[model samples]
Target: MAMTQTQRFGIFAALALVMAATRIHHSTLHHFDALPDASWGVFFLAGFWLRGAARWAFPLLMAEAVLIDYVVITHLGIDFWSHYCVSAGYWFLIPSYGALWLGGSWLAKHQVGLRLSTLALAVVALLVSESLCYLISNGSFYWISANVPAPRSFAAWFENLGDWYLPFLQTTALYVGLGAVLHVLAVQVARLAQHRGQTQH
Candidate 1:
């Protein structure tokens, strides 16, 4: 049984709201919460359930992320460039997230075992997604201030990389762990819905 376009939209919209709300509290408190954020799940499910519609859904997801972060930055009085840094990071990471989601969604079809697979996907996502964030913000830092770090010594470069990458790695790990759980749940719900639909017919 195939999911209808309306069904896909409803699923994606609901997931987006979940993503937004869950992140809001954590971001406001400057705390990285362990709740599952649905942004990547939305993008993944949107692609799996909606196909071509995912093109629009992915960008809209990114836009929503930027808007939410912007509001938080304003409320927190963080530098505006920080907002830009995050937005750019999300922009860079979206494709990696999308690909991860797509891969997981594909695995779902085969009833591929969940726990180990989910962890693997989450790890892959954490690595690439966080790395992208580090790269984007590192570039931004360099652009804003030259001589930020010299590659003259291995320790110097390592410290510079750590300054940019460590926080992102922690955040991504937390976010992706929750996301993996949510992805598993979403697939289950969709399966139940499909089963029910078949019964109704």
Candidate 2:
């Protein structure tokens, strides 16, 4: 189903809020340490629901992510470039997040309905996209970032990947899964309302 302009705006606003709220703590603040960043899931869902708005929306979200990081890092009285996460590898986030967006876009294009098949397809898409994103981000950080010492190797990189992969994957899956549930519930509610209106008429 094509989303109306109002629906698009609503989704955009919601995604922006989620990115800001979650990332504020993600970057530096330990106060909200329990809340993992929703960036990966946000980009994925944006691609699914706001595919038509990609020309502008994708860039907007990317800007928002950077802006959020800038604000948080600066607020802490630290120089942005000097921050540990700010490295040559940081630029790779464009392609990393793009991988997620494309995955969701692929699923949206191929999705038939809310069936088991659709669920299976979504799972496959999520796994593929997340893996690719992780590879780009994690591999770049390990191999290219100055933060890692000069003695990096495939053996060490593989071990480093293992250490962080599960946490990132689990956090992303949690948000995306919750989004899926909300989507299902919203669809059912809309259908019920429409059916009641028809019956009344």
lDDT of 1 by residue, 1-201 (tens): 255778767866876787688666654233444663445444544444455565677677767776776787787888755553443333445555566456444534543445676456545644554465455545544444333535355565567777646554565455445555666687788889989999999
Top-scoring candidate (lDDT)? 2
Give candidate 1's error at residue 192 in angstroms: 6.8
lDDT to native, each model: 0.57, 0.87
lDDT of model 2, residue 51: 81
Q: Model 2 off-target regions past 4 Å? A: 28-32
> Which RMSD does model 2 reach against the true structure?
1.7
Report model 1's TM-score to 2 decimal places. 0.55
User: Against the true structure, what is each candidate's TM-score?
Assistant: 0.55, 0.95
Clashing pairs in 1: none
Superposed by TM-score, candidate 1 places the C-alpha of residue 181 at a distance from the truth, in angstroms, of 2.9
